[model samples]
Target: MLYPPHQPLQAAAIPPQRGPAGPAREDESGPWHTEAVCRRDEAGLFFAPSKEPTAARLSREEAAKRVCARCPVVIECREHALLQPEPYGVWGGLTAAERRVVLARRRRREMELKKAASAPRIAAAG
Candidate 1:
């Protein structure tokens, strides 16, 4: 169900469960989630508390990313986030802002690819 299940694994994304509970892993969403490192850490570490101070939030995010760094399922987690376009929290080591940037870049890249594919090819005069 997640990203067609055939794409090559890459670093980074997550789902809309970006609430205070953090990322959600369903029993049928496949087994990659069972191995997430974030599962062992506090959910609050990934989601920001309302009205949290800037410095504290950054520190917490860094900590969460540290956990994600060693995660074996980081790629799956990140892909989930990007596909779902998770609106908040950190997933697969990326903060919400970072995910937005990534999504934008993906959109731009997709457009470029589509344009290239649709362009006319020039023939050589023999």
Candidate 2:
């Protein structure tokens, strides 16, 4: 699920890779990346090659999403992608096109909320 607009976006804070590492620090600083499955994987898996065909791109994106599915920082990654409006590759299991859709929906929802908030309410009839 996407992060709520009212709340500050926060890292998911999933458990660190097996074994004790003392208490996991709440303050993240490049530390949240230590547990990412993609760090040990190839970049090509997440990005498209030049002149890629539609079928190949689809296959590659699916593979990238699979990696993201098991990723620990998927939420944080997704938020980054959506907020940044990343124009390429897959992040948080969503392809570029998918991220566009999410961002559009979020923008519409925010607009609707703002509109409703400004509208005056009618008093109940006695």
Error of 2 at 56 (Å): 0.5
* RMSD list, candidates in order: 8.8, 10.0
Model 2 residue 39 CA deviation in Å: 1.0
Model 1 worst lDDT window (10 residues): 3-12
Q: Rate the local accuracy (lDDT) of all candidates.
A: 0.73, 0.69
Q: Tens digits of per-residue lDDT for model 1 on 55-98?
A: 99999999988988999888877877887777888888899999
In order of listing, the candidates' clash counts read 5, 0
Candidate 2, RMSD to the unseen true structure: 10.0
**Superposed Cα deviation of residue 35, candidate 2 (Å):** 1.9
What is the alpha-carbon lDDT for the whole of candidate 2? 0.69
**Pairing residues by index, what is the TM-score of model 2?**
0.74
TM per prediction: 0.74, 0.74
Residue by residue across 1-126, what tens digits does model 2's lDDT show? 322111222433343432232233335544445555776677788888899999999999998888888888788677767765668888878899999999989899999999999999989999
